[model samples]
Structures are given as C-alpha cells and as structure tokens.
Target: MNNKRRVTVILAMAAIAPLTFTACAGGGAAPASGGDVKSLTVLDSYNNDPDKGILQASIDKCAAKVGVTIERTTVPGKDRMQTVLQRSSSKTLPDVLMLDNPEVKDVAATGALSPLSDYKVDMSAFAGNSLDAVTQDGQVYGLPLPADTLGLFYNADVLAAAGITPPKTWDELKAAAAKLTTGDQYGLAFSAAATYEGAWQFLPFMWTNGGDETKLDSPEVKGALQLYVDLVQSGSASKSVINWNQADVKDQFVAGKAAMMINGPWQIPALAKVPGVKWNTVQIPVNKPGQTPTAPLGGMVWTVPRTGDKAKQAKAAEFVACTGTEDSQMALGKARNTVPTQNGLHQKYVSEVPTMAAFTKQVEDARSRTGKLGKDWPKAATTIYTAVQLALTGGASVDEAFSKAAAG
Candidate 1:
C-alpha cells in the first residue's frame, strides 16, 4: 500500500475510542510453556493484488521455513488497525501482526506487541531509521521489510521538450515549475490535502530547510510553507492541491496536467502501465546546495504480538525473521517496487533496479515521522496539514498559518 493509505489508516485508527488495559492484559500474559505450534494466525492489510500476491509468496516461504502452517487474515488498509484494537481488547490478538511503521509505537505502548529481543531476532542487517520506527523504550517491536519514501517524479519527455532539467534545489524547482506551467497544465503537482498525506509530502521541504515538527511556526517552517503558497499563488501549482490525495496527484501527472509530481515508489506499478510517459524520479530537492533532502520513511513492519502462547509467539518471531532475510528482502523489494531495509544492499539493489537509484539514496537518510514524537506524531501531522491548507487557501498567510493551526 502507499503511504497515503497508511496515513489514512493510522488517522482512522486514532479516531476510535481509546481502550484501557490492566497490567496483566497490557503487558501481555505470561508465556505458557510446552505446546506444539502447528498453525499461526497472521493479520495484515495487503488486501489488493500485486501487494497481496507478493506478500503471500513471502509469507508462504517463511511459514515453510518456520515449520508452521499460516492462517492469514487480510483486511483493507483502512480497517486493519481498528481490527487490531478490537482483537486486542478481546484477548484474541493474532499471533503475528503487521503494522504501519508509525502505528507500531502506539500499539507497543499499549503492550499489545512483544519485543523482538525476547526472541533474540537479529536486527543488525536492518536500516537504523527503519528500526527506529518500531523501537519503543529501546526495545524493537517489529521487523521492517523493504520500504518506500517520497521522490520527485518527473516526465522526462516533458522536461526534455521544455529544455528543462530535473530540479536539484528549491529555487530551480520554483523556476522550472513556472516555466513548465502553461494552458491546462501546471509546472508541478503534489498532494496538499487536509490529511497526513499532505504533512508527509511537505516533510522533505520542511526538514531540508531545518524545520522541526516540534517547532512548526518558525522561520524555517515558514520558508517551506511559503513554497506551497508561492506555487499556488504564482499559478505554477494547482490551487486544487488542497483537495488532492497522492493518488489524485498521480492521476494529474499521468493525465498530462502536471509536468512533475511529488510522489513515492508505490505509484510505480500504475506508472509502468502508462508506457507512453517517459518518467524518472529524483530525490526531492533541497532548499540549498548543502542541505540533505530528508524524506519520511514509508512501509509496514511485521510484528509478533503478545498472544500468550509461547510456542506460537516463537514460531511467529521465526517467521518474521525469515521475512527480513536477504533473499526475502530482495525478492519482496523487487516484486513490490520498494527498497530493502537491510544495510549493505544498496549497490546490489541499485544495480538490479537502476530507476530506483534516487529513492535508494533518499531512504538512506530518511527520517521516521514517529521517531521523535512517538504516538504524539498524529497530532503534529494534523497541525502540519492544517497549516498547509490554511496557507494554500488564503485562510492565513504562510507566516501565520502554522501558528493559527496550532492554536486550534
């Protein structure tokens, strides 16, 4: 699934009424000893094809390696978290669970997940940022698979035709976007919806400019916000961005309404189908030459939940570990169009999928949305998108937008 779907699922899950837990319930029951585990229950939200099929192949391989039969339950992304919460309350949590990276903390905080350390799952191969998302109180709760992050996807044909090059800095982006804008087409397109997806899209610009989520109303943030304001005001980007999700932005890019777009690798499959468009991706531009483009990390993590059955839990951990192995990572990454979380695989992965070079580089330094704020990230994400909407729609000036949104 795309990060937009991941964000929407998280936000939807957050809206549900909070559930309280007793020490025994929250901390998970003591593991029962001595039982043969034949089948393990697994739950995740890969309900669509390609993702669904690709994930199933991995699961089947892992299950065979772990000597267990899998009873997997797939739900729509929007409903997975809610289902997890419901199951948690009823003491029927799946033996294995898959959570979006950011949601790991919230679920782990509730003691619904077991630390991977408990099973001595080896994590040395995974990327630090990917591990950071699933770590709570210094304990890792899950294993991340190949991940995705945002990038600047441009129509190479469009850029060549306009005598333009892919932008490398914010100033150049603004100029290129303006130069590309003409009748019925904008120079650039991006999601600025009043949702976490918008907050996510803005992160590269915000972080590259030295803005922090904890301090959203500062000069650095203002500069980032002003880029959005300027794009809309100068007619280089659609005013309709405030209503567009990432999918809508991709549609705009695919339909020739946008010369370039800010999106992620999850859109690759659909873009591949449109063979006529000569598209390519680059890391989102930095504000200045020295700044590193820091995009938000995107992907789900496979976690072993606190199911109270030691045998099942042990088998589940083995399964999760198998999924993180080098062979599994490469296979899944290739099949799903994502980057492997394993370290030292960059050169090999890039050599295999040349078009993913920019994204591979981006994920190397990508930051997790919940890395600093943990469960409180949803609130900060809300503040960000609210600010974007206000600034882009003239509800407030760029300088005033974050402050006003924070106040509400």
Candidate 2:
C-alpha cells in the first residue's frame, strides 16, 4: 500500500462518547428545498486575523450559493482542539469544522468527525499527498482545501547587503549564516524552540534526509539532527532559538533582524508590507548533492462533523466535496493568491503569485509525510524532535539521542 493510502483504522476515541450529530438539515439533501436550513454552525480556528476574514467570506459565499443558512464561530486552533475534545466529551460538536492535518489526526482518534471515504468524488485532482494527510484508519476524515509547503523566505536586500546569493544547500546555508551574522542581524531565523513552529521548520530537513519522522532511528534523521547541532553550536545560529512560549521567528525575519527564514505562504502578505524590504522565496534545500529539496507540507481542510443525522451528514459531505472541486477551486484562485489543490489550478496560482511559484512547485514534488507517520505523527514527531534537540544542544550523543527517543 503506497504510503498515501495507508489510512488509520483505529477508533481509539470511542472512550469519549460520540458527540450529538446533525448535518445541515432544515432542508433536504441534494437538490435541497430551494433554501438552506437557517441555523447551521461552523467552528474554526480563525480567531481574528487574515484567515478569519478570508475564511468567513469563503464560507458565506459557499453557503449562500447553496442556499444554506449558516452561522460561523472562530476559536484559536489550539483551543479548537480542546473544543473538539470537550465537545466529544459533552456531546456538543459543531455541524461543520475546520482543521489542519495534525489536529485532524488528534481529532480522528476521538471519532468526532465524519469520514468522507463513502462520499463520491475523484481524488486525482489534489496535490502532494494532502488527501492522505487527513486519512485515518483507512478512512477519509477531512478534505484538504489549500495545499502549502515551508520555504526559505529571504529579504533580498539582506542577502544583497551581505553580498551572498541564496544558499543552495544546507552546508552553504550554514557558511552563509556565519558570514551574514553581524550586530543584531542574523542570516537565518528558524523555529528551533520547543513549539509547533519548531517542528514546522525541522520536519522538512528530516524529510530531505530521506527519513520518515516515524523512523527516528534512521541514519538520515540522525544526520539531519547533526546538521541542526552544527548550526547552533558553531555560532551559525543562536541558542536562544530554543526559548519557550513564542513563535517570533518570523517576526525576527520580517524586522530584518534575520536574513532568511522557514515559513509558509501565509507569511508572504505580511512580509510584503515591510518597507524597503525586497524579499524572495525558495524551496528549502537538501543537505548535499543527489538529494531532492524537501518541504514539510502544511495547509487547511474542511470537514463535516459526525452527526446522528446521517442524511444531513451526507448532504454536508457533498457540499464539502463540492468546495474542493475544480470549479470552486478556480473561483477561489480568481480571488486570492492561494494555489488550488485541484490539478491545473497550480498553474493558475503560479501565474498570479509568480514570485512564490518556486516554493509552490517544491510542494508539488514533495512527498507526503504519511504511512505509520501519518497515524501517530504528533507524538512521534515531538518525541524525535525533542530527542534530536537534546543531542544537538550537547545534552546527548548521536546514538544516545536515537536510543533514548526510540525507547518508546
């Protein structure tokens, strides 16, 4: 079974009582009853930001076009996870939900969202193994909407000031870091702290080394760890990167304190706003020759909550699938710089956001982080990352890092 199709089948969340279910139902399924049920709810993690405004508009447009009356709510993504857990425990799950991949796995373990495997739709139009990212226990739990990847976002002026070209390989990146470091200025800003941001940047390196994060004992993973250690211990990077309770790496990059960073497409608009800043983006480079450039995929997805009303759930699923189709995707393309997950929409978004095209293409060729890793990924990723950080920071040996982390 190609890793893309290795869906998780475990329904471990049965321990938490399934939440009360109801699909968008004041109206009938399919053709509908001319108008949508006036009182439907969607819970998402867009608590007041660009994602909030754009996503709410998208929801309103889709729901209105379908004649469905829908209400929306926003919560922090982390808090949304707790909401899913709480709702699963209290039986108050929302009718619709928005989540990213890791949260999808955590929520799936609780059996709260409806699986769309039975929903009729072709999967060939999507990118990366994004569809696979949301598959759990051999079932489709969510629909990946916009696909994205992490990349090196550099202030063109910063690199230009230092007279260095963009680093083409990890080794070049380190060398450039040394040359670029100056008073209050760093050549690189990465998410090395113990948080989601840390893993976001670190995972791509592990993938470039040809190691699934699920296999922490692999040599590739170890080599990736050593690279990170070399960066920090050798003064190529700052040790304060590990300081807790923040995601300010991008902030540093944007303010010109750092010359480059590993961030997703979401950072583009904000970075563009910084004056006198000429920035360009590129795919995260591999360690050396013969290895492909790697980028850990990231993106948002839509899903219907598992409900007692099977027919309504079915209706909602179809609508969700419709939102993923080529037409809706193209419509989305017309309005934003977002690349559509649909087959050809990539070309379209590339033209629209030309400067960011290379980064998007990297994601297209990038392999999905799946299989065993897809199932229990969050825990495994944290375990391996923490272990690697320990060794890189001089707390453990390379072998000891693997041995201690793999002891699980």
Candidate 1 lDDT over 1-408, as tens digits, reads: 999999999988776525432333455555465588888889999999989998999999989998999999999998988999999988889999999999999999999999999999999988899998999999999999899999999999999999999999999999999999989999999999988899999998998888998889889989999998988899999999999999999999999999999999999999999999889999989888899999999999999998888878888999999998989999998888899997688889999999999999999989999999999999999999999999988899888899899888
- Candidate number with greatest lDDT: 1
Off by over 4 Å in 1: 1-33
Per-model C-alpha lDDT, please? 0.92, 0.71
Model 1 vs. true fold: TM:
0.92
Candidate 2: stretches off by over 4 Å: 1-39, 244-246, 330-337, 367-371, 406-408
TM-score of each: 0.92, 0.85
Model 2: clashing residue pairs?
Answer: 7-137, 7-138, 8-136, 8-137, 8-138, 9-137, 21-307, 21-308, 36-67
